[model samples]
Target chain A: MLSTLQDEKQDPRVKRTRSLILNAFMEILPEKGFQSVSVQDITEKAGINRATFYAHFPDKYALLDHSISQMFRQEIEKRMLDACHYSDENLKTLIVTVCEFVSNANSHCKPSSLQFESLVEAQVKNQLQGLLQVWLEQDDSDVDAKTAATAASWAIYGLVLQWSHDKNKKKPSAEKFADQVLPLIAVNLRLAQPA
Target chain B: MLSTLQDEKQDPRVKRTRSLILNAFMEILPEKGFQSVSVQDITEKAGINRATFYAHFPDKYALLDHSISQMFRQEIEKRMLDACHYSDENLKTLIVTVCEFVSNANSHCKPSSLQFESLVEAQVKNQLQGLLQVWLEQDDSDVDAKTAATAASWAIYGLVLQWSHDKNKKKPSAEKFADQVLPLIAVNLRLAQPA
Candidate 1:
């Protein structure tokens, strides 16, 4: 399924419109920024009418949302689940998966289609908030799981945020990052350990 | 110091103006929204002159920033930091500190200081950006630690955004919340551990 996306991205028409809209998005975003992106502007740039653009996407925000959520969902969710089991090996694998996932996603989707600033809270938080809720539910009834989940979920979110912000030369290896960050997560899981 | 501060909050004149500003802030927030708050409005309600108000704060945004950051730095950081060795505990504490700080800051600052809609990347990313750069410069060079820090920081920032947009009960039980969140940090730290 993932491999199929690379093939799909090769379509010239898809590439053209998506690129045009994205270019327009970038131009508008840093200027008037996210709040100002208009459907007409995007359509005009792509040389398509409002109707044509609407057929492709419901609205400017939705198109931008889809571009980001679609690109990274598979990788992020996979990391969340892969990190579910408690073992050193599992942990190491999860770290690489996540850091690499973030790195790859940044390389592929960024400067367009995946600018984090433009994300609306409810839209972006849906999956992460849900993931945290489930994780916090295990062996926990005392604390507000949602809040805990929110904190934990966000830490990973922070990790990714931190990863993407660096203006590195050679680029930081995601594997080493996984190593540095993984230890921070281990202490919280002590509560969930088998009694 | 804490007792003196508490006493000051109880003084009649201070209490009245403070309450007035806080109340006005809440009412204006949902209606005119965050960025729209004005000096005249705040002064009118508080029954204070602009000069007097300025004595307390440089501007409305500064007041809001101080309010939120004050609540967070005092309450959340005290709990999350172990002030100990450079191990998993240190990182978890740091992560939890960040998540909780953001969570608390977002709660108070949203309608007041945290006008994400109005802020540019320069302001939002500036101080934190500098701090992350310092933390990432080390043998840990393999990781774009600064970027990772920013990403993680923003994730917490993002979570707070989600929380602000949702309906949740507000109570200042820092201990309860911190205990709840510690595990998720543990998990992430564990996952990020090096081989």
Candidate 2:
């Protein structure tokens, strides 16, 4: 769902319009949620007409997809994980990032519905798979990159989702939780190694 | 979503009614898919009234949940995997079972929508987590059983999903694929083991 103009070379006007629409959408999301926020609401908040909003996004779901993608990509870049290899330190950082992201998404959204959660999951997992495949390929592991990456991405996401939903008062911090499960997830990528 | 009467002590009449509803659902699912099939459709197909259908299930989603749970449980039991502890062989069998179930679900439903797939996913993953937790706890692993089970269940489901969707002409058989990924998944449960 990446737009061609999503890069730095895009026209200033296009970038500004997209940024305004995204900002307005994000502001309304906490108040009305992804389900209740309408196109008209977003357009009015952004000081843009319906046509301008439509030109930017086909609908709210598409907007959510784009927003989640951008947010998750930034999370990866923030830790410089997008350029990293399959080191233990990098993997632990990735897990922490995911834990923080899922936790933040849950708390930020007014009332995160199942639809919104699944949409975020789909976007995040897609990017996770891509980033993981690159890491696996770069490591020159014997295991099939695509399958291992798929399993690892899902495993990491599932664990963090569980962590985010933990109701226990003594729930561990994200870094602590990631460190506890680090070896478990690491083995999924390098199957030949002794844990 | 398991009914109180979903056991051997259940009344024969209740069992018969539930069976009829489930059978009718299984029959209509392939013809009309999950979304298009309604309570009326199930009732008519089962030669029962809407009230009788409602007596067994609250709605079509609940019916789908119960149906999937039964089917996957039966698959697990058929291999005697439910009665066993964590072993390399049993784990391989579980992965193969998931692959087969996912493949069957995709083919049985006329055009499986995202909603249907996600519903099935939630039900299957819940059961898988329960089963895996039992296995992990029985093995007395030092790792946290709850978190490890959650991760392993999602990993197995995700890998099988990717396998089911493989467009390659020479995609591996379920057994072969399971063998390939067995070590990767096994380590998720027993962190101390050497792969």
**Counted clashes in each candidate structure:** 37, 0
Per-residue alpha-carbon lDDT of candidate 1 for residues B121-168, written as tens digits (9 for 90 to 100): 223333334434444443254554444444434433443344444555
Pairs of residues clashing in candidate 2: none
lDDT of 2 at A158: 89
Model 2 chain A worst lDDT run, 10 consecutive residues: A1-10
Q: Candidate 1 local accuracy as lDDT?
A: 0.50
Say which docking band candidate 2 falls in: acceptable
* Candidate whose DockQ is highest: 2
Candidate 1 docks at the CAPRI level of acceptable
> lDDT tens string, model 2, B1-195?
233434567788887778788888888999999978889999999888899887878789888877888888888988998999988989898999999999999999978977688777888888899999999889865767887788889999888888899999988899988888887787787662321
For all candidates in order, the CA lDDT equals 0.50, 0.84
Candidate 1 wrong stretches, greater than 4 Å: A1-38, A45-48, A51-59, A76-94, A108-115, A118-129, A132-148, A168-171, A191-195, B1-31, B35-195
Error of 2 at A187 (Å): 1.8
